[model samples]
Target: MTLGRSAGGVRLQDVADLAGVSMKTVSNVVHDYEHVSEAMRDKVQAAIDALGYRPNLTARRLATGKTGMIALAIPEIDQFYFAELGRHIGEEAARYGYRILVEQTLNDVEAERAVIRDRDEGLVDGVIFQPARIDTLEIARLRPGTPLVLLGEAARPVNTDHVMIDNTRAARDGVEMLLGRGRRRIAFLATVHGDITESTHLRLLGYQEALLAAGVGLDAHLVLQSEGFGFEDGVRAISSAIAAGVEFDAVLCRDDLFAMAALRGLEIAGRRVPEDVAVLGWDDTAVARYSTPALSSVSPDKQALASAAFALLEDRMQGYDGSGRHEIVAHSIIERATT
Candidate 1:
């Protein structure tokens, strides 16, 4: 069909004609299918730009039954972690010839189910999920062909790709580094969530491993839990712990914002950073480096994780039978002024 021309509208045929390639070749380029010559890709892209031949995504879904969008099921991005993940995921999806539809669960199970519902309703082609609930019963109803990828622990369904950090080692390494710097009394910091969330559970596991290695008995008295991950929330957590007469020579937080909060709180509590008590945190965010005394932290590369999630999910969408894949990005300690 002619469909329509430029300054008005253009059809897929126009793109094919201008590029001197078959309609199937144009389709392959649009879908980013490999084996298309670079010359063909260049010609098709130029034609797409020149002819203003925007593929009607809705119409394409009706014709092919494929939504050219990816759904990202994330917990609320009020903190840096998910925000950064979202940014990188969107960029990665763009590279894979897909768009992103973001859904936030606020850590609510019902909300998470709703995200799945929206996906089943043709809202997206696949899902990259950071699940707050790892229980089997919850994901039992996930629609087949949804091409889901899991991040963090309790990765379920057993038939999808997953990417996770070594949460235990991240914590263990953070603590031992502090001890190595002559800070003996160390504590792990994290925002306490309901027992279901793996983030809190795994980070604590890693932190405890380090304490055991250092011959420091795990002190429940020194564990400081926050209700949130904001910088101010971190400050409040540490401040309250100190006011209650808790004694610790070092604070290891689950994230950079929390680490900075610990530093701020410690200063207010009349402690000198690295001088009196060193502080370390997971997630080497930019703020970690720019803090008053550059915060030492674990470089989790959340952006890289997000990028990988979308890339693999897109592969599944394209009919690749890669099997239920799992990937773990290596992490390193970012030593700074704090420890």
Candidate 2:
């Protein structure tokens, strides 16, 4: 029997009939119920493909009281690390039959609070937040019972799930790589004025730790502070350091964008990469691989981070009432042409 594309097109019952299975079985397959056999799933999926069947998401949401949508809030989507991480998180969310609704918080406190507020309104099933400005206490106060997975180097709330790499250890390894190459005059870049963020504090601590271990005193002048964490911020910071007669044979940046900018700034200052100034970056973003002389970087396992964060969020969504579970994903240094 041929199914015609009419008023509502193909239905679930139509797909079941075509697959020679009960409607319940088709429903199970559509919902990705684990108890369904692979053979039955394949049969139902084949019929679904043949008829171009689409599940009624509105009806499902109404029946289950879940929107099957996840909210991902980040400081900036344009930043290389966050952008790459979002892509990975999106792919991981799809594996669980969910779509992502991204909210760019831009490190604004109000914007970050809005994401938690929206989740309370039942707009999305849960939230994956990477907060930059707000602290853990405020997040805990705002999200009393919402399913939240905190990302990045922010202090994790007491009872909220969190996922991140060990920033201090990763930074130490990156700097140690430079030290192993006989680079003593290393400049730690990407410091900001005022209250330091957790990420910057940890990375800088690691930088100092490595220098101290090598018996090299941390020079106050070699630590270049930036106005912000943007590409231009890096460029200006490095250029100003050069113009001000800062002497350094190596530079370790907080992120890939800064490292790439340092490359340009150094070139403008007539310093050859590796030969005159070795540069290292964090995040190991795609740009790191293609930058001039390539960027040696600290590579965090982004896929593992997404997987762990989603797993925690999924557990929370499924009524897991345990305390906050903090997961530390793996990271390593990628020594490229720059070092």
Candidate 3:
């Protein structure tokens, strides 16, 4: 059956003929049906590649009711880490001829719920969600039908794809580095404190583990918690620690912003980085390299993260409705003057 061509363009049957398969088989292959045999799928794909068959996205959308666009919901766009992640996701999406629209949830529960339900009946193909306020139980209940790829640790074990770095191991490594440098009394800055999200909880666990491994006593007073993960929060955290007469020889910040603020606050308190108090940060953002003392940080593979996220989304878009897949990209500790 010739699934009608548009304006002298190749049709589904054209690929079917070239692959020696029926129109339905060609369609199944194009749609990435897993039930199709690998040999048959390969034949159809080879034909598609040889013919350079470009499917008309607009026409296909009219038939399938897809928008060819995806939404990336992050906690906040102002934060350098999220902003940089969005940039990477957008670049990856462009490779598949798809555009990404970024939505800022601002760690608000209501905004996060809105993002889940914003599918609008295929107005957006799917969403790459990085929720902040919503809990795992809430996420399971609010399972939208749209294809979703969850980013970061806020995602639960629902039927979705998740991509993140090894927060616990990375945090442990950073703390161990400080310990190896003969620095004790290391403080954890900008943690959610008590009743935190998985990301914060895992990092804190790793910090405690590191100290315990090094035979260092866990000091509750040395752990400075922050209400939020912002630069000002970092400043307040450091300043408060100083005023409270906390004696810390090193600091492990939650993110680059906190590390940057800690650097400034330490200076204001008549202290020097790596001399008085060595500092370490997560998410080796762009500014990490240019900080006065060139901050040390844990650098997650952003390119690998983007590629994995896009690949998972594409699989979902093509109707791969398997179990929840969690992909872990690699992360490395970037040593610098700060350590």
Model 1: lDDT to the true structure = 0.77
For model 2 the TM-score comes to: 0.94
Best by TM-score: 2
Candidate 2 lDDT over 1-339, as tens digits, reads 222222357887898889999988987887788999898899999999998887776666765788789999998898888999999999999998899999998778789778786666777888898988888898888764668899988758878889999998888898888999999999988797663468988999999999999899989999998988778888999999999999999999988988998998999999999999999998999999887687899999999999999999999999998889988999989989998
Off by over 4 Å in 2: 1-8, 194-196
Listed in order, each prediction's TM-score against the native is 0.88, 0.94, 0.81
lDDT of 2 at 320: 98
Candidate order (lDDT):
2, 3, 1
Q: Where does candidate 3 stray beyond 4 Å?
A: 1-60, 192-196
Q: How far is candidate 3 from the true structure (C-alpha RMSD, Å)?
A: 5.5
Residues forming the 10-long window of minimal summed lDDT in candidate 3? 1-10
Task: Give each prediction's root-mean-square deviation over alpha carbons.
Answer: 2.8, 2.9, 5.5
Best by lDDT: 2
Clashing pairs in 2: none
For candidate 3, give the lDDT of residue 299: 91
Q: Model 2 Cα displacement at 46 (Å)?
A: 1.0
Count of backbone collisions within predicted model 3: 0
